[model samples]
Target: GQHAELDVMRKVEGVAISPRDTVLVDQGMMTGRAGIFAGGDVIGGLMTMTAATGHGKKAARAIDVWLSGGHYEGHEKSPPVDFDMLNLPLFLDAGRSQMSALPPEARSGFVEVVAGISDREARYEADRCLSCGNCFECDNCFAACPEQAVVKLGKGRKYTVDLDLCTGCAVCYDQCPCHAIEMVADVAALSAEAHRPLRFKARP
Candidate 1:
């Protein structure tokens, strides 16, 4: 129910305020004044915890870049992962871990009701994540490739396919458990070689 004291900020030169009484910011969450930034509730629009957290993270990055005298281009956003994209067969069907809670009879004013899961239970629940479009480096594509085209680029670097060794087989694409590999026609090879060439797009 508390209101934002925007009147105080209005006195500052080059700071913009919207018609909705919210602070105005640019793509980098910066105000009209240089080195100044605002986000979350002050910026208005979607007023949720998740939105606020995202805003905070973005603003922090922008602030860091500004401090370093560099422009913040920001990280590219990936497409949303759909349920159908997940390899359901790879993950076991496990029920959600239930948290312990106090009984109705034990309930009291300002008392905690739900008790959170243990560290082991939390780890188990985390392991159940389908990972969807994100590759977990399961080595399925590496093993399934008949021509040994899939090349491991070490940990966190992901895999790359050797175009010379690849024979246009969709084995790597089919073996990818997370659906991270996409098969597209190599236009350059098709135009030059007069035959279709396999291009694997493995998103990191």
Candidate 2:
């Protein structure tokens, strides 16, 4: 709380800010000086709890790698998902559930305004998630793959494609609601397409 102004500065002693901006971060979330990494509100851009959480995670990873004498190269930024990209049919049309609130009489002090939802309500709310841009491991790929190429690695681990068994039929890719699966053709597949015989129709 005391270092609130540090939230707006260009650099912090050993750290160097970008020439073009006040933000301090390189590929590995490293500041110019050794070992020190900065993120969160200090880095600017999206000023939200989600953005701060992401920064904290990235900074932690970078710090760990720095300690180990390695670098944590973060992923390249991709374009944000648009509403059109979402598979709306996969999500139920459920209205946002309001949190149970304390009665006006009980709101005199600094008590929390909203109470937690019931387990059933939580489940219902979770069911309404569109799961845009990220994989929620729905197992649609596991079921859709005729060759049984999709390996279920249990919750949080997600599924991996068994390339040997995957014929590149793209049934799994097509069936994926989140568009998480990608069909990457091998050199052999590409060469086969180049050499495939084109049939000529006989003149009637």
Tell me the whole-model lDDT of each prediction, alpha carbons only: 0.83, 0.67
RMSD of each: 4.3, 8.4
Q: Estimated TM-score per prediction?
A: 0.69, 0.65
Q: Candidate 2 lDDT, tens digit per residue, 17-100?
A: 655454567866677777777676666777677897888877887888889988787755545556776666766668988888
Write one digit per residue (lDDT tens) for candidate 1, span 1-204.
345678876988999998889889988899888888888778887877778788888989999999999988887665776888766676668889999999999999989899999999999898877777878888999999999999999998788889888877888888776788878888888889845486787764
Candidate 1 error regions (>4 Å): 1-25, 29-78, 193-196
The candidate 1 region of ten consecutive residues with least summed lDDT is 195-204
How good is model 1 by TM-score? 0.69
Segments of candidate 2 deviating more than 4 angstroms: 1-13, 16-23, 64-68, 77-80, 99-127, 193-204
Q: Where is model 2 poorest over a 10-residue stretch in terms of lDDT? A: 195-204
Clashing pairs in model 2, backbone N/Cα/C closer than 3 A? none
